[model samples]
Target chain A: MTKLFIPLDSFAVACGADTIAEEFKRLVADRKLSIEIVRNGSRGMAWLEPMIEVETPDGRIAYGPIEPGEAETLVDAGVLSGAGHEKRIGKVEEHPFFRAQTRHTFKRCGITDPLSLDDYKAHGGLKGLERAIGIGAETVIAEVTDSGLRGRGGAGFPTGIKWKTVAEAKGARKYIVANADEGDSGTFADRMIMEGDPYCLIEGMAIAGVATGATKGYIYLRSEYPVAIDVMREAISRAHQAGVLGASVLGSAHVFDIEVRVGAGAYVCGEETSLLDSLEGKRGQVRFKPPLPAIQGLFGMPTVINNVITLASTPEILSAGAAAYKDMGMGRSRGTIPIQLGGNVRHGGLFEAPFGMTLGEIVNEIGGGTASGRPVRAVQVGGPLGAYFPVSLFDTPFDYEAFAAKDGLIGHAGIVVFDDTVDMMAQAKFAFEFCAIESCGKCTPCRVGAVRGYETVKKIIDGEHPAENLVLVEDLCNTMKFGSLCALGGFTPYPVMSAIRHFPEDFHGEPMRVAAE
Target chain B: MVFQARYDEAEAAEIIGEHRHLEGPLLPILHGIQERFGHVSEEAVRQVAAALNLTRAEVHGVVTFYHDFRKAPAGRHVLKVCRAEACQAAGGDAIAGAIETALGVKFGETTPDGQVTLEAVYCLGLCATAPSAMLDRRIVGRLSEAKIGALVEEARL
Candidate 1:
């Protein structure tokens, strides 16, 4: 009779959504009401998590941050009729946070049952696969090329070119590897898609297989995401049973299937080469490029490795056409980027907007500033390796090339805000420490240089030869930036150097005052 | 105390056999072994190496490389606190200190009664609710001193 939706996404679950769901089930049974609860993926407005939506004749009504104890009170107040309660935040789509987002890739995430193929197809799912299968492999690559989709894994390489390279490369059997190892700290776009809308990723990977003539696909997911791992495994099995996977996909002659491989807790495995090595049951180490993964990859066969978001965006690009997808954003970044706002922000969640929104709008207007109610000191755009942008650079637009021009990276687009109380010196040290911990030790610059960087920053923090060590730190960073094999060592200097550049007062003689006294 | 059924070579071999058909079966087999027993023992490594037709050094290297694999049994429960930048920005240092004091054990150490083992993790992707931690597969976020105290008490049980 009546239907209620609750999120099964990990973030919601962590916030006690499961307990609240159970409470609702018990209350419904006790009252003998004709009500049904559907477990849906999160709407990404994490602040209002454990958010329950009730389906009415008009539309779905939303209420949230529902504590387990409040379920009884809310339901007793005739929540089924979409009655006004203090918790009711009206239709979710009308909310400021949801309204502002462009929501191209994440269109169906917060809505629909993630596992139901009928629901997926009902909400514009398999149109892309059908279109790809109809257009043939060459046309699929051409469409992707026209869409201007680049690697969302932070490299910004053209996805169409990669597929074309794999398609023409001389190989009897090719492979499609989805780099789902989302180890970046403030990033969870990959995790959300995998848990919320797995078929979207599965469909994208299948399209890649059809386009590249690759039959086998593997999703190298991180072990930290146990819930995503479980959801994906079940989703893959369901896809196989429904003919979305396995031989003769959707009754076509294009034989393609997918497998979910878990990564051992190695952050370095996020690198394409390191992920392939880990997939082969070897130590997760980076391999030198000359022959990139597109040419020789995954057991020495040409492999098309695309990030979760990059692959997930394809279903829409194929369904909506390349021009529709291409016309949304500014310049080269011609699509919606799912920017994850976290840390000390008041309204921390995923904001999917087209490129060209200034950092000021994102932090102040959308995020509503810090949760601590203090003046914002710095915002770290990207992950641990990304630079810390001061308030002065808040005018910088959310674009790939723009961030690079600012001597920073839009890596994975995870913007973490910090209040005025943050210590930039400690943050600088952490940049090096994180590198030292996660480095694959492939190159001496990353492995040893990181340790030295950490120690050098520590010396600066202790006010030891502050002038001399600052120069030493700069020289060491230059060495690592030039000599390192991968971004793990190369880009680490972004945070370290940016901290010194933007907030020099923190890095000099302040902590030593107590010792001097 | 940590519940570890004595390591059986036959059981380890059976788990290894289950995954041998897949491409790159070592990591999965090791995961299977660790799940069966609390830790990956030296003898288990030897059996896996022999079964996979690889050197013992190779298997050992893999086990050591990844942070997830354990060489010995842990306490009854494992607690991992987030140490990444996002968490650090959200009073994570205070959370870390409070948990250590509450549990009477440091990051990589187990309590005296073998009740809980505390460890530090980079991130759990719960940055939205910053200052997060995972206790025995259940994630607790937006952590404060009181929440962590309760978590420590739950681990003891």
Candidate 2:
């Protein structure tokens, strides 16, 4: 029987794919098409789904965002016609968007059954966890270290270093945390991981637990990812029932349990310390450093907190052997990162590539320029905290050191591309405004400076006190950068500074000509 | 809007006792009560306060901290328009303007009719299909001027 996988991602919700899925099953039965159609999570490309992939002798042939009218023709066209459609953009793998990626963590995304453990297992799912359980924790960490795995969440910290910290920490009680607070604007890779392959995250956490001697784990998820929360909750309960969790993990004495704590909307909570605070049922506020979360975290216990991509990659690194995983990237940053390609881009989705691809290749070659077919302009990497890199910096490699050298951070590897029509000034104002809104209201510079900065930006845009306001904005940005308590305030300058420095023309109140017209 | 904040000592204890039988029922029971009372009631707070061996202030502290755990009633309908960059890029600001004009209420303010409240949200992850809005908890996207008006009309009935 041909297995028909229908992606049930949020885009599917927007596209009304659920009704289509039920109708599809009914139609298949009526038509007596010898096929098995399964509803699964989308393949990350939101524009292309409600997209159906029909199993054929050759491979999975695709169709739609399929309208009811086209469903019959899809099957009639040999189901494997892999028919050329406007949405197809031709072969799935042939598309530069997917081709540029090295999808180790996201290998099964949009391709396999997101809800099926059996399909997951068939595609080398629990194999890494199996090896980890078979060999024990120390070996698992070693394999990860050898694979050169780094946290896919911004900061690019070595995953091995994190696991080792918790593994060696002297504590009877330990905690494993999954940072599912994907607060970055252009980022969706973390959400995709949580939504699509939650099992990978679970197994990765289990391995961390067994390796580090931690017994309890918590996945601190943002409430925005309601679907992820629901799916992960269901997956956790199933894992518990299957003995994948509890006292005997995979029938071993390594007893570790995991729970999901849905975080109220707080961007600051994405920070490890704030996340810990929120987990303890406290306000989603940031705490001062000196006691790093890995050391004294979550009820003052030694905690191993990692981003979604880090946990997901751990399973693959162990299963595929370390060298194979390590052979991808350059410099200190290694392994694959599932970069979220989005915003005003033509071919947008998730691009999982190594650490050293150029922005030009990514935005132009991979993304195919602007979504509206305008001339390519600026691209923002990282999150809101990241700088706007003009075409001048497109030659800059995506690695940590390379980007940092150019005064930008890779952050979570989210690339937001914009066309010439984009207004940098408004975008700059929004950054300060966002910081003002989400700033947890902890410290003065961030709390006061953000709103002040927005006001100054408004002044500049209104063409009031142009010279003085410009100076004021710059001075204010510097203060926020140096004085703020956290990245929320400290890094708001990247956009503001970049807009003023690289694209000063944008902030000059409509260029005098456009407004008059 | 119905859920009240748990404020007093005895009330907190009562609240905790009320939700004791639920399965790992601390958050759910608290949320349920909060939903019903606008915020967790004082009685509920005190009840939860006692059951968890926490102080009344502690319970209140947690409730007030989370933005979702409201201390007062919400309008009958909440129209949370996404203020994320993707949506903003796709004309969210224009949509926000139309909403403000139509409802005569600014962001984070409720209507006098108790019918609606408008608030700003970061990202709903509905960027690919941008210019989205969340009516209550449902994510609604591909939003335009006409769609927003139609939605308000539908919610009226």
Candidate 3:
């Protein structure tokens, strides 16, 4: 019997994958064809979503972005035999979009049955936990330490050091928290992992638990991702049943279990401390540092808080050993980063590769320029708090240190491209507006300064003392950058100041164009 | 219009009991009440506060802080349009204005007949497609004027 693969990833479903799947199933049943339909994760080529694959003697042939009513046309054209169709994109792995780069963390995302433990294991899923358990906690920590793995959750802190701190902290209970509150606009890697290869995260968390002696874990997922929440909850339950979780993980002496805690739409909660407070049933507000989360976190117990990709990256690190991951990247940034390319890009999707790829290569070459077929104006590499880079700065490498040196951040690695028609002044105002809306109101500089920032930018747009207002905007950003409690306020300046610095013409020119028009 | 019964004391308590055992059960309990009752009413908030042994101020603060929990019942259908940067980059502003004109209501407003409620969401994590929206549980991506019109029609139905 032949098998057909369709993605259940949220992006795919949003693009009408569910309807297409139903159509395929109806067609398959009507003909009573000896065919099996498998609901797999997305291939990350989101442009080609609702993309389906057919099992052939040579390989799985791909076709996609299939319309709601196109399944019948495909079947009639001998799709079951991998026959030629206008929609066919050849083998997915061989596509230029996919064939170019590394795919360690996302290796199993699109290929495997998202919920099948058997499929997960077949794709080398739990080997990290196995290695961690076999090697013991200290060696597990050592492996991660030697791997040079840093947090993929924008901060870029060393994961091994965080685990080491938690392992050594004097607490009766330790917790491992995965920040699934991927509130960044252009980023969805965390949501993709949670929906596509949830087992990868579970296994990674289990390894963290084993490594740091943390007995319990929680995934503070955003409520925006209802699909991820449902999928993660089910995946956790299944893991418990399969002995991959629970009192004795994999039937070992080490005890570890995980639960899914949904956030109530607070973006600030993506900050680790606020997430802890939200998990504790309190208002999600940023807590002041000094008692860092690793030292005193989640009910004052030692905790290891990492992003979804940070934890998801661990299974492969432990399974493949530290050196295997260590040898992959450049400078201080080691290992592959899953770069989410979005906005006006023609070929928008996830691209995971080692650090040091130039921004120019990523936006122009890999992304195939803008979808509008217009001149590329700006690319915002990172989430809301990231700096906007002009085409002149496209030569900048996609590394944490390099970005930081450029007064930018590789925040969550979400690159949203913009065409020349964009209004930078409006974008600058939106940076403040977004900060004002999402600010936790815990710190004065952020809470009050953001409102002031928005007003000042509006003044500049209105040509009210453009020179003075511009100075005021810079002055306000400086205060927020230095005084704010967390990244929400601190990094708001990146977008605001970068917009002013690079696109000075927008700030000074004839009456600023309205963004909504 | 979708008919939702006013919050009942006993039913709210029962919903609270189901999630009370979990660690930090307030959010879950609140979610359960809203899931069953369509929105977290003042009475339900009081019930949750008393059940969780916390003050109403604390519970109310939490309820207000997060954007997800609603204080009253929405229209029969809720349509959330993405107002975030990625969506805005994909001509979302025009789409948003078009939908508001078609529905005769702005963001955060419900239609006169209670057919649909309009909302603005930051991001739905479908940036690769850009310009996404969620009509209740079903998320739609690559949203255009035509698609938004269809979504509003579906919601009205």
Interface root mean square deviation per prediction: 0.8, 2.8, 0.7
Error of 2 at B154 (Å): 4.4
| Per-structure clash totals for the candidates | 0, 35, 0
* Two-chain DockQ for each candidate model: 0.81, 0.39, 0.86
Residue-wise lDDT of candidate 3 within B13-36, one digit each (tens)? 888888899888988888888878
Candidate 3: deviation at residue A392, Å? 0.5
Candidate 1 residue runs with Cα over 4 Å from true position: A509-517, B1-3
Quick one: best DockQ, which candidate? 3
lDDT of 1 by residue, B1-157 (tens): 3457898878887999899999999889988898889889999989999999999999999999999899998988999999998888788999999999999999999999888999999989888988899887788888898788788898899
Question: Please, what is the whole-model Cα lDDT of each candidate in the order they appear?
Answer: 0.90, 0.77, 0.91
Sorted on lDDT, best first, the list reads: 3, 1, 2
- TM-score for each of the candidates: 0.98, 0.90, 0.98
| Ten contiguous residues minimizing lDDT sum, candidate 1 chain A | A508-517
